[model samples]
Target: MTVALTTPMLLAAGPAHALLPNRSCGTVTSADSTAAANLNKVLTGKLRGSMTAYRLSCARAIADATRARGLPNQAAVIAITTAIVESVLENNPNKIDQTSVGLFQQLDHWGSYEQRLDPAWSTNAFLNEMVTLYPNNSWQNQQIGVVCQRVQRSAYPSRYQPEVADAQRIFNALTAPAPASKVHLEIVGADGGMWNTDGDYAAGEWSGSWASLGGTGLKALASAVTGNTMHVYAVGSTGRVFTKDANYSTGQWSTDWAEVPGNIQGATALTASVTGNKVHLEVIGADGAMWNTDGDYAAGEWSGSWASLGGTGLKALASAVTGNTMHVYAVGSTGRVFTKDANYSTGQWSTDWAEVPGNIQGATALTASVTGNKVHLEVIGADGAMWNTDGDYAAGEWTGSWASLGGTGLKALASAVTGNTMHVYAVGSTGRVYTKDANYSTGQWSTDWAEIPGNGAGATALTASTTP
Candidate 1:
């Protein structure tokens, strides 16, 4: 029953174990950007203290651990409060009491030194014992000090209670509700500046006039709303990808356009989608391959530099997310539509660009409008007319056929679903913006493309973000 795990065997096997807690933080791979941001703001406001980034990261680690365990905010608050008192919100760098360690200062009885030192393992072990003692979530009704004392058996249980107010404040600030969910349409105006407009898509009304975000030499654009902020990305004509964030709740954007790390030279198309905590951004880079990156919007950083999702001769691209699965669609060299997927939950992808079975070949460009588990894929047909197909994420099936939306010369496409309706925005060859709607319940497309009251034209790209 005991097989030795040799160096090679252990090296290969350990990553899966390591990644388990790392990925399960609220169905996200769990980036700590928001936690870091919240800590900075709170530390500066009323809890004025010199907290190091390392200590802050430890608190974030506990937050991620609590989320991974599928626990409530109260659990996080209690656990974090305990850590705040026990080890001052950090896994002790130097062991104390000869056997106690980690954020919670877990003792030898908790687990091995290695386990006790891991913020995630110690947090979980504490919870496991806490749950055993307080079955049926009886801990939910108990006082924060009582729960912490029961779990830690601390000598000074009163010490934990005094910290609950700060702990609750930190958790509240970090888990504050995301900005009001609305669709932010960022597009390339005729003058090449980045223009944006917000609409209560769920109500079918624009909130304000389009404002210029001020850019030059930009080519393709992609956008998504994550937390309380809107992230807009664009590739300059020179092929450098740049990004900026507009925190709607704060009513401010990042002071400048920060360049996204990575060269996506000759990017012909750009698309952005939000999945869990990270924003998945990919572009058709030079040599006709898809180069992808994930942005940690809260942390304000880009990771995975440029991972190439090698499909050659790809044309325009579009992506949509349902739950943790991201569906990326692209037009192939032969005019056939192909798609692939990335499951954030399992960190895996479809083996290849599988041909969609609708025989809807000869497609040039496409956009995926996701409502519930359904993806309403709208594409420009070979004849430059609008066509559509549907895919169900829950069932892993696509509609057996493509239907004509009965339009021609549709040049650009972007769609946002609010409530049960899919609002499709397209640009015609005449350089006019038009919108049509599909009511999910009635299964009906609007009678005609109603031109919006805008003379705005000459847009090369469009992207709309709604609540995930």
Candidate 2:
């Protein structure tokens, strides 16, 4: 699945509104024993005072509130610290003083009893006032405790100081790298069945079983992830383009395939890229030329007829969209890689394809991804070893010599980029899946390949994309 920019995908739990066990004298305890016990029970371990269970929920509430209000992480930290100092990260519905309640311990002046109990609503209320008090991210440079005191104006202003360390701990844990929710794999079976994993590869199981879409003429398949929907394109045996959409949000797929108006020929290759709401589909046409069409899924309509990209001898196709530029790559009949540059902003494509500087003429399959201005290409060499090349899109040139990502019996390839990390997936001739991870920030790929447990024998095509 090729990733398109959209909303953040993460599992969210609803707020727990029960009150924390009350403390005497209105002095907030270092840790709520009952809350800690409940958290440990949920986590199956004793991580005292960390508020492990509530951390993610409360953090998400703070994040959503700040984003909606255009506030910064600094403001989020201030709110978190205030909540930690007041209720130890517990949603205390009972008033500690005169009608104070919820995570931030806001009084009746903040809102109604029910409003104060709603974690998300209370978070928004707190951030709204905090931003009003310290506009333009001015609170970022101040001490966190001081910022919290300024926002809360608590009777004991110094009380928030001791909770700073715990607040920072919770914040860091919440902001740490989340597990990928949208690691998707689409494969064309030898029987022409379209098989797909339900974007749950991170859980070590590709959905208990692969879903068979029951298509008989699919030659090559490609998919793109935009928001909560996965758009799939496959080449029919008769050289026609067919598309189907799967809504991850609803766990449903279009009941039937929709024919895309395109005249493709022979054994076709399919690849897609997304620019904003527009999805561009590229295919190796029957006439050996490249054909392209686009649609705005948001508007629920296709744009125009398929336009010939005017290229020949293209065998395998792959594409990536970086900002306003779309990079389409293909393996020529002679085995060398050729690329066409399309500028969406200018509504123009390069008149001719440029040869990438590498000896990849005999490659059987290839995949590509874009990170920032750099495009990374990996190909299964004629010798069955994986070879890679990096292109500088801004500089309009290939940057380095072809490097070997050593492997043998490789039969298929797919790749996805997350942040500065690129994950490459491949299937070996023995029907085993393997992965090679590279960090673009550190300029290195894993020296060895890790094999996936399950066998993937007889897969004709493999494609991958990450969810937003």
Candidate 3:
């Protein structure tokens, strides 16, 4: 029997009904930032006209709905496209349609009027409908038309095909191929920025700033940015590393500024990870050497022990870590990319730098997940283009050829990954952040970028999930 739900009951139980299966897009568990960059260029080019607003709103609504359910953070292209085809998301606002209204155009009689108008409620209902209809099929793999028909059963099912392509295009613009273990950060200003830091471990649509930690001449450059449960770590002026941690439980932030203890000519960049609650920070020391630390991110523990990973061409950049291996790559003084992977399991890091097949001038990023047997990397070419590399971390098979992903407005930025999709997000020189995703189906990148809600070169973290 169908149970009647009151407004309070429905609101309280919203998390159980969102679109994502198990409702959590596992943290950026795997990624292909290089592919993500390429797709961003493609999708940005595709977004235009009336389609732009509808597509954006759809994607935004789906993302919001997923978050409301406490489900894994999902990119919104699929549900957005579904709405684009179903209702064009343009029902009259002044007058109500008893049959359907809002983004999904839900029929009012099917549920409460309030629920029908709510973005989260509509998306959750749609996802639940899909699950009830196709309990065993893989929604991610099914053709768009097939998946849509399974849920909508529209009179002209075939008419929905074009929207599937639209959905796929948007999906590729949103889903990440892997996790963001390494991110490129560049601080453009000291203006306190407003952001949501509690979830996704990132700053979104920034505005306003924290209490000023006075340090003028805050020149920003491309540096490695990493995170832990309680703090964000980045390279400060003159190559010093700085950290800011929060005690959300206590609604407090540590005010003490502890400088990285290291004798260096200058610091280049920083990368870090949190494993079993311990924060690990890695950076290029003043002598053009690699330095690392293992300490309490919340309590501020950094040893500043310097470890030299030898190579003549080090241009201090970013690094990403998995299981026990840390993949470090950078743009050399000569503009070529030099990479090394530290395998903690063997108690030894790679002794020699293996050159990735391109000349990079910015930080390189990497990410991986269990579903894929590979690690993926992305870097900015000396030509200001983005290039990518994929390798089998466990099999020791490396693919080092560089492929060009074109974009004109991208600046130094950060990325995160999930599954076989790579989400590359970058701030435009115009101060707008853009995003695009690369999927495995076409084995190619989307040709445009979608505008994000805010600005800043800090980082654009991503995660994804699918409902049954």
Candidate 4:
């Protein structure tokens, strides 16, 4: 069945609120003062001489197709390497070789002109055949080139071998775990109104109707993607936590709000992370200490009562889970940053809070994400500037010095790492939304912030996640 892409409908609007900017330590970069810019760009259709663009376009199509079929990265690598050897990853409708065309030079027997020409469709068709040839998951153990050769039955079977390295490089670059797909964005309006975009920032639109599930006095909101579902959590006016679930494949949200079993104070900060099939939530309790709860998605139930993590004077908290290791960060009342580590496999949490070195102090809001073995953190400094610190979680070493990304009047902050790209969303004191993008592998951020439309004044909370 062909899935028709639909535009997301616009949601409800609300009144604006004045939010004070938090002071943070950092030097303002003149480049960051400019208005934000859009980073979403489609690379499909016909390809020219840009090898980088072609590789990215092919990788995206393959990734989407494989994901749809519930296939793994091995299948993606097979499809990409086949395309690289066949047409150098270009979409060539004009190329005529006994009716073969498109990225993989698929023949007429593959499908009709349109179907064969569509990057995603062609890749899907190729993968379906590949899976049929290797249904036992044995393809995972074979050389990528050999797998492609078996599927394509090309006359030059060895041609695919030479492109294996390049194919793997491109696949790794495009498939790195990202906090959210580059195409999706989640926003919380005043009065706890929630909205999300369905497509990429370049072409996606907000939902038409806002779910009135949230209430006034919503202090912090967070989201995480687990399998094919997106989970959103919000702290309502009554100091209670509410959650809503959405099926990313169908773009449908649950009709009612489910209250989480916890008693958090109003204005408490909340952060969420997902590893395997379990969802972890951390928040500042009424006692000003960090508390946590776990949601088992596989079991469809919450586990245990809220457990105290044993830290005092905790203000803002953020958590990141890489595999079974969960890392949590928070700003102490004295303006210092402290971290705790947990290993779920061992069922253990760090014994005590350890201050991050460099004497970094005075951060108001904190957000964190992990890529590989590295942990990246962004904080609202006391000087009202954005400060970022990164370290190797496995090695226990940090950069120590906080690097300034440069923005003023920033109130709320949220971040997600998708593929090899890192995205940070902030609601300025004016209540307008701005975003900055960085290549997570390079640790280089875009110079200017791009303003996201539709999120008008009074965007109190912001969270982001890629569709699973």
Candidate 5:
């Protein structure tokens, strides 16, 4: 049978004021010795010292999580009680175990070890299990012993009451919540459009009727951080640079693509690091030189007019924003990456070009961030090999010489880096999308190629979704 925890399980034991006083658990009022002993057995060495801190942290976390689910304060109590009775605030150590690992003492055999050890993961698993066992949630009253007897069917079912009281106290004392990490992710879908979400794999499909656009409709997907929305400016098929937005919120798409001042072609979209709501759009001008327009906006309207960024060439890739400045690198026919940018306030373009060491141009996928102000660029070399360079863009120095990550199959490459984790995805000639993800925690990229879901061969495009 699928066991679960339900709403009723969260009901306060006794009077709310009498049972738990103030914001603190009052006077160590445990239920009974029997319940206490069972709790002691499970809790063991775990719940010593900092009782106040422990109780506050756990209680707050439980409350925060339940609040999102529209649950009341009592459910938090239930989660706390269960956690206290199980691992006593100490998570299970990392090691192969016959039983599931974690604060819930889960056995590794149940699932992957990596997931089992994650605190949030363990909490989620326990909550799911609770949902399964106590579908009606009337289980809490059996006292800890009777309730545990119904679910765990422990060898010693009689020892539930004592443990329950301790669990309750721990549940009450530790009630502070964990802090949330704020981020902004801008997702560009296949249709020359952009949206925002904090999830991975943003979803949208080509809704076009034209057969020539082929089943080959665009999916210009991209993701950045979380929270902030994307600024998009593109040259439409009509020979006009049409702009729109799908950043945060819902219901309707932005209407009317605005026309830019100059006669342009091959326009690419990018955001500025130092300026808020500023988009730097680069395109090949009528003279075949690279020209750009910089405009700032908020709430989906342009506040600044399109301005000129003097340069030349078809080789331009937007640098990830850093502080108040953003770098745009370009390559001419010789196949080398070049750089230029303006500070946050003036929004002026640099006068001269600086070449990156080694012949590095033509169809490149790049990613960057503020941490150390670093940049990573990959390109399909003349020999059809994949070469990468990593270094500080502002300093114009390569940290290390160019390294060949792999060969041949690097077409349509897209890269994203968050914290220390770097992920690169590309379509292989063999008709499969290949992936390389670096785990920041371990400081290493995974050695195998992970295939994306629902995509195989046949001209696939790779974009990372950093929302959910």
Candidate 6:
């Protein structure tokens, strides 16, 4: 299974957003560094309170993340202003009140402690909710402080206004553009041990060699990233689910497995996404119904018990998110593909599942990636070959036929996108993993599938997630 929740892809059909001219992330400019260095001297007097170089950099991160989502300048102002009011523009990890933390003083309800403390992840989470609350561009007519208050539900709601001007200048200075980064990968290898490596998009190569995170009996897996913090979930042969945490920022991985709460046994296929306040999960439960659950995984808890999504005899789950709406796909018992939508902004789901019209049937694995407004769906067909199609949520349609991505004896599969190219990996009948790439710019795929080197043979299932 594959899920996409980052900013829209860098597409071949058009240019990047004007304010965020670069597709890269996590870069701060030399000029911005100088400005940050001078902040203590220049901001001795307060707009509401004084800001240090660190605080200014936090403001810049907030600004960059907001603009990357193609949101307006005012959205950045509102987010920065809210952070200033809540934490004096700091990414505070200490719980201040009622489990509250982060620059926005968000409680664990917003996410795990690590998520709130990650400036990039926290910024995206704030924007996710703001867009949801202000659906249909409603925030444009409201005051910036009012928008902040509505999203925050703060006890002291009036403080945000006094800091808006300061936030606006900070947002402007940091919105110039930044460098690029790709979502790094961790795979469950042939040995049932976890293996991870970093990728360099600029060099088109793995930045590091595959290294092992020792484990055994892991059959299937899914993962989600909140900045560099990764929460990995795996299903054992007996259907018991286990989770582990990896903080790439600090180069550490937890040595023990933690059982996720909520009696999530007998789950077969799984998918997860990083949303506004939590890591949302979709599992094909023991009863063959799609079940949903989410939580602050860093703290080892689910938001609640798993609730059924009510699909009959479903398998092979893959989901994608576009503009606050999530499109979930499943392969029904009869081998037909079905889909439903959840509008996060409105807190509603499509009334029922709709059959996707195509030659796609008897799918054992499904994975998808979003390029611009369209989702490119790939499936391993009943005939043991790969097929591709597109679902355009903006237009509310799916392709009537499937094109051949061209692989043979393929088993389980997963995909991820970086820039204009989509990378796909699949488990072959021999249990070895092979990959191929599709270039959106040239509408071409590698003529022959290339096997990924190293000890990844004998893999059973694969999952991939994208992070901004």
- State each model's CA lDDT, in order: 0.77, 0.76, 0.51, 0.74, 0.49, 0.76
lDDT of 3 at 211: 32
TM-score of predicted structure 3: 0.48
lDDT of 3 by residue, 76-193 (tens): 4456666766665432222234466656666655477566666677788877776567665356566666666767666667755566555556555555323433222223343422
Give one digit per residue, the lDDT tens place, for model 2 in 1-468. 998969988889999887555322122332333343444444321124355434446555665566677766666777777887787666776876888888788998989988887777888888777667778767677888887888788989987767666555555555554434456777777678787764454454455456677677688888887777888888888878888888877879898988876444563887899888889888888788888899888898886588889777778888988779899988888888888979999989999998888666688788999888889999888888899999887787786578888999898788987667888888777755678989999999999998644444567777887774
lDDT tens digits, residues 38-133, model 4? 111222222222344334555567767787888877777778788877877667775457888887888888899778878778888888787788
Task: List TM-scores for all candidates, in order.
Answer: 0.63, 0.63, 0.48, 0.62, 0.49, 0.64
Two-way lDDT contest, 1 vs 4, winner: 1
Better of 2 and 5 by TM-score: 2
Clashes of each: 2, 4, 36, 22, 57, 2
Which of the two candidates, 2 or 4, achieves a greater lDDT against the reference? 2
Give lDDT for model 6. Answer: 0.76
Local accuracy of candidate 6 as per-residue lDDT tens digits, 305-399: 88788898987888877878777889999777888778877868788988877857788788877777888888888888888888887897887
Number of the predicted model whose lDDT against the real structure is largest = 1
Candidate 5: tens digits of C-alpha lDDT, residues 71-117: 54455555555555555544545443355455455675546866665
**Poorly placed runs, candidate 4 (over 4 Å):** 1-180, 198-214, 262-267
Please give the lDDT score for candidate 3.
0.51
Give me the runs in candidate 2 sitting further than 4 Å from their true place.
1-181, 198-208, 263-267, 394-397, 430-432
In candidate 5, position 49 carries an lDDT of 36
